[model samples]
Target chain A: MTHEAKTVSEQTRERLLDAAREAFSQHGFQGATVREICRRAEANVAAVNYHFGNKDGLLAEALNFAPLKAMQLANAKADGNPEVRLRLFIRDFMLMLLDETNGSLPCRIMARELADPTPALDKIVREAIAPLHDFLGKLLREIAGGKTGEAELRRCMHSILGQCLYYRHSHPVLQRLHPKLRYDHKKIETIAEHIADFSLAGIGYISGKTCA
Target chain B: MTHEAKTVSEQTRERLLDAAREAFSQHGFQGATVREICRRAEANVAAVNYHFGNKDGLLAEALNFAPLKAMQLANAKADGNPEVRLRLFIRDFMLMLLDETNGSLPCRIMARELADPTPALDKIVREAIAPLHDFLGKLLREIAGGKTGEAELRRCMHSILGQCLYYRHSHPVLQRLHPKLRYDHKKIETIAEHIADFSLAGIGYISGKTCA
Candidate 1:
């Protein structure tokens, strides 16, 4: 009976989170009301407050889910070699990014939060993303033999991400620029592989510093 | 005196644009009202409507200015070789992105628009980016002997822009990951270089033929 109660609670929590992600992604944090999330979840108004304490808490709860899932996937791709692990990390991240929606409202909401990140952003970073960063950093450090400057490694990693994420974020502009290729599956596939190849060139340069 | 009148009109237009850019960067399209923009510009609401029509029109106008200007700058560096022109474009784009922000609010807003473009996004792309595309496409065709697939080139170019833009967009997330490097100038510089180097490698893969 105790186990049944726990399972029910878990299911409720998951439902709330899914609803919150959709709500926050569409309306953004400031615009997304707790009442709306409750309505979407078909739960009580106080339920979100009970489960997450506030809108910010709910947003954090939803946002943290992806990073945690992504990190787990990324970490599992860790081969014996740090370089290989880092490469896998990049690939996994790109794939995760591609799996996102057309408008990428979730990532956009997250981007907005970063600009004026509330305290909630910190919690997500601490709990979900920090582990991924550490994993990537350690892998990069091993590849660099601790010789690459921290700033350089951060820049290289961020560039790799930026390249991968560009298509999702700038779909609107790219759509206009290349109208014929907006939803072309072949185009997206080419972009993914192309970005991966280029990012490797830049990241490998940083690792090469160990020899220099 | 005709030239003098043109100068004054240009100056006012520039001021309105500057104000729009500032407001849009800080508050985003949804959050920023025309009153705020007018107040920031020290111009009247009527002035905004006269120059750019509705709020959406104003946003389109604001988005149009930078990329067009950027293309002009990049085209100046064009040396008949598409590869060289592309490298120049990436380098110039990165420099402009770096110069345009401090804490990256602009980067955040731009990233959001890319992720989830709307009607306003259309004007920016159609009026502004279309020319840039034509210019780039012709250059690429020249290099590829008019043989590369349209989708392949689009992906490569998008990847280049993404690498440049992502570094600033994710700066805050990165800061939290490496707490000690928050807002570090050296870090931004390093990212610019990394993006340039990496994207160059990706663009370098343009052998002109549709392959794999």
Candidate 2:
């Protein structure tokens, strides 16, 4: 194929991926259709099959389209006090989960996966969640001064994460309960601060450092 | 209708509801079919309409089948210390979420609603979640010695709840991350304790008690 043809083909593939991400985020893997994705992408009906082999192939690619590099960036900035690191980490993680302008496609897709898991969940766990878990575990271990038991550390880590994810998973219920609770940048910052302070104190207490 | 015929009709209605709860829990409201529900209940295909009016009506009833009376019971047992009440509340809440023998139908159905919500969400929020939220809020306020701001107290309540609900929402991912992790009776108790301790410290810190 000529250079121009190849470029056109690549553009079509990219459009298909973009359309797939939006469709999958909205309708999930099972609910989304190749015809709809193709229509949204303005590509030929066969474009999905031609580019990604099948719908499953497209889903796999779409699920990984947005890498969670923010987590890695947050971890790399682990230079200062552990408390500061923890706070920054919660802020960044919450932003990823709550921010819309940052394109909440990944989080929404993951929520769909959680609601009705497909075979893609295994890869998602290995690629995205496990790394996040390990990163938080290391940070919590440092904050706890290595004195807390492994199981306790894991629970603490989960407590912190649960606090973060609750905002996302239960967004609808929360809105009803607190009609004015918006996840704007300011509110996100406040929530991040709350989780950070709450978690730091929790860790300190469990490690027998604060209460002692 | 004769007494014996009315008794048989009531039994059929009960069976249909049982089938609906199971189907809605497993397949969600949208995914579950009246035909399938009737098949499971060994009733006529038209029974869903005759008994419950429609699929939506059936969904509404099935959603309310289990009344979350455990939370009410737990709250009523709140007699002595605020901290102990909070711990017992967390324990009861987590048991309701994680206990399989307790029939996780309500939790699973709620999870489905969160994933792909219908109009029934409003009722759920009002009937089930709001009461739970209010109960936890009052407990947190007492624990914080009435010094914590309402906003802060709400976040604290969310933190504790987030910790408990995480075990349910992220069960699949958690299992993948820690293969040995189980939500058995003993493990649930341990987790309940961890969340209670962690959250108490968080509340104490945020309310300016523990750190000072």
Candidate 3:
């Protein structure tokens, strides 16, 4: 294919991803229809098959694209201060969960997958979650400032992530339970800072170090 | 009705609740059929309407039963030591999550509700979860033992619950990530200790107290 043809194909694929993300978020995987996605994307029916092979392929890609991009952005700006890095990592994670444009599809999809896992779960875990875990794990180790066993390290990491993830996963229940809780970006910043402070204190006590 | 007739009716209701719990856990709210639950309970169709009024009523009751039992057990053994009480609370909550016989139906149902909420969620949160939150919030307050506001108390409570809950809500993802992580009673004890220690350290640091 010529350069112009290649550019057009790439644009079509991107449009399909955008449309699929919206449709899948609102209607879910099985509930979302390819015809509507194609119509919304302004692409031909053959475009999905040609680009992604099937709905499952598009589902995986659509679910992964934005969060992965957020991860990349977080990674690029990652720096030396473990505390600063932890806060930034959490802020980016909260952004991924509360991304306005995607309407939190990545997180909602992940929750659905957790309830009734799909084949796509493996790919998402390996591609997105595992790497994120490793990244956060290393940062905790630095802030901890001493030798910690695998189990202890993992427990600390889960505590931090669990706090961040709980807000998104339990947003509805939380809203009902505490009507004042909000998920806007400003509120998310406060939450991120709270989680960082709570996690660092726990880590400090565990590692026998004092952290600010 | 005679006393004997009332006993039989109570037995039937319990049996139906058991069946509905299993059905809803396996197949979800809409996917679980009244017929299948009846078949499993060895009761006739009219028995459901006669006892519970409808499937929605059965679902709310079934989802509430086991966790309520777990809470009752924990509450009976509750004492003044905030640390011990916290440990017991985490252990009992873990048991409620990993109870093999009930197959974690309450957690799964709650997850589904989080993903796609229904009217049942309101009742579940208000009736079941709010009390638990209040109970946990009090425990954290005791641990903090200072001028902690509602928000700080809640963040601590969530951090503790989040650690205990992570093992259940993300069981599949976690199992995939850590092959050796088990949920046996003995392991639950260790996990409860870890969470209690981690959480206490955080609370201590926040309260400006020295914690071991």
Question: Which candidate has the top score in TM-score?
Answer: 2
Query: Distance from true position, residue A75, model 1, in Å?
Result: 2.8
Residue-level error in angstroms, candidate 2, position A25: 2.7
Cα misplacement distance, residue A119 of candidate 2 (Å): 2.3
Model 2 spans with C-alpha error above 4 angstroms: A1-6, A31-35, A65-67, A209-212, B1-6, B209-212
Better of 1 and 3 by lDDT: 3
Q: Candidate 1, B105: how far from true, in Å? A: 11
- Predictions' DockQ, in order: 0.48, 0.70, 0.52
lDDT of 3 by residue, A1-212 (tens): 66445687789999999898788765556557899999999999888999999989888777754565566566657786778888788777777676564365676667556645566888778877787788778778777765777678887888887777777667778888778866777877777777777778788777773232
Taking all chains together, the TM-score of candidate 1 against the true structure is 0.75
True contacts kept of each: 0.70, 0.76, 0.47
Return the lDDT, model 1, position A94: 54
TM-score of each: 0.75, 0.89, 0.82
Give the Å error, residue B80, model 3. Answer: 1.2
DockQ score for candidate 3:
0.52
Predicted complex 2: DockQ: 0.70
Q: What is residue A209's positional error in candidate 3, in angstroms?
A: 10
What docking class should model 2 receive?
medium
**For residues A1-212, could you state the per-residue lDDT of candidate 2 as single tens digits?**
56445687788998998899899877778778899999999998888988988888888888762446666565667776878888888887788778876675776688667646577888888887787778788878888976778888888998998898888888877777768867889889999999999999999889894325
Which residue pairs does candidate 3 place in steric collision? none
Of 2 and 3, the candidate ahead on TM-score is 2
